[model samples]
Target: MPRRVSLPSADDLFRPTSPDGSDRSPGEAAERPAEQAVDQPADQPVHGARPAPRRPSGRVRHDEKMTVYVTSEELHDLEQARLTLRRTGLTVDRGRLVRAAIALALAGYEQDGEDSALVQRLRDA
Candidate 1:
């Protein structure tokens, strides 16, 4: 058997420290500004009419991963598109290009319903 050691309580371990050594805890730290931010909708106007619709921020957080299998010609077309965008000074990976295309297809489907280009392309195949 090993010797037992004493440790601080959970409260002491999680307590937030201040420069002046005050007794503020992590819970208290979280309650300050977050409450106000959470109380309001993100897209709501602070003071006035409704704001314009938000566009895609284009920042990939990569919270999820996906695997796609493409033919050699499809892969070549994707690489060509990536190179074309690079020539236009928009540096992005092929995955980003594919993601943008998916977003466009989804938006077009939503806007056009059965008459969407996405549906037509799928039906053609």
Candidate 2:
């Protein structure tokens, strides 16, 4: 007879942090029966605002895949930009550069709406 082995599920593999942001194991801190008073900084986010930027790492884990087509000139420009960035001592792949650019554009649009550079460029095209 073969023995059975139990494996962790996806949710167990990627469990989220607790609401209070502590790394303590579950049940280590007794669950509060009532709302607890917390002293937060004046600049703390009010729930709707975007979260802070993540630390830069050479690799990013992506579960979903996307396909983007670029012209020969655009590909050349991207490679040149990659080389220029490499010369600056910050090593990053083309996908990371594209993702960072998208994040900046989205942030600008969120801040300035219609007057953002992203909006202007899209409207012009």
Candidate 3:
């Protein structure tokens, strides 16, 4: 059996370490200018006006898990494809490439379903 390893949490990865083993909160790390601070008066608009809207956070919305199985050779092919795409000036990782291919395939399948309607209309004409 393969030995299992536990992954560290994001907090553990970014947590500050002191020589004496003390922890520092994230807010204590550094301060910005008053104009740059989120809570500062200058950072807010006058007359209670709202700032420009921001994009919805691209973070995962659910605590869901998935398991996928791939052979070593398949994984190597994926890595090679990722490298090739990077060399061509299109920055893409294996996961992104896979997701894009899946999306394309789904779109093609939907279009295939509509092909019969077009074929029947052509035959009627």
| lDDT for each residue of candidate 1 in 16-77, tens digit (9 for 90 to 100) | 45444434444555656765435665445577665434334254334467899999999999
Residues 1-125, model 2: lDDT tens digits: 99999999998876655444434344544563344324354334569876454333234345456899999999999989999999999888899888777778877776788999999999998
Clashing pairs in 3: none
Q: Could you give candidate 3's per-residue lDDT for residues 1-125 as a string of tens digits?
A: 99989999998886545444333444753654565445544324457575333222122222334567989998999899989989999887665677665555544444565565544556787
Worst lDDT run of 10 residues, candidate 1, spans 52-61
Higher-TM-score candidate of 1 and 3:
1
Q: How big is the positional error of residue 93 in model 2, measured in Å on the Cα after superposition?
A: 0.7
In model 2, the clashing pairs are none
Better of 1 and 2 by lDDT: 1
TM-score of candidate 2 versus the correct structure, residues matched by position: 0.57
Give me the runs in candidate 3 sitting further than 4 Å from their true place: 1-65, 114-125
For model 2, the stretches where C-alpha displacement exceeds 4 angstroms are 1-58
Q: How high is the lDDT of residue 70 in model 1?
A: 98
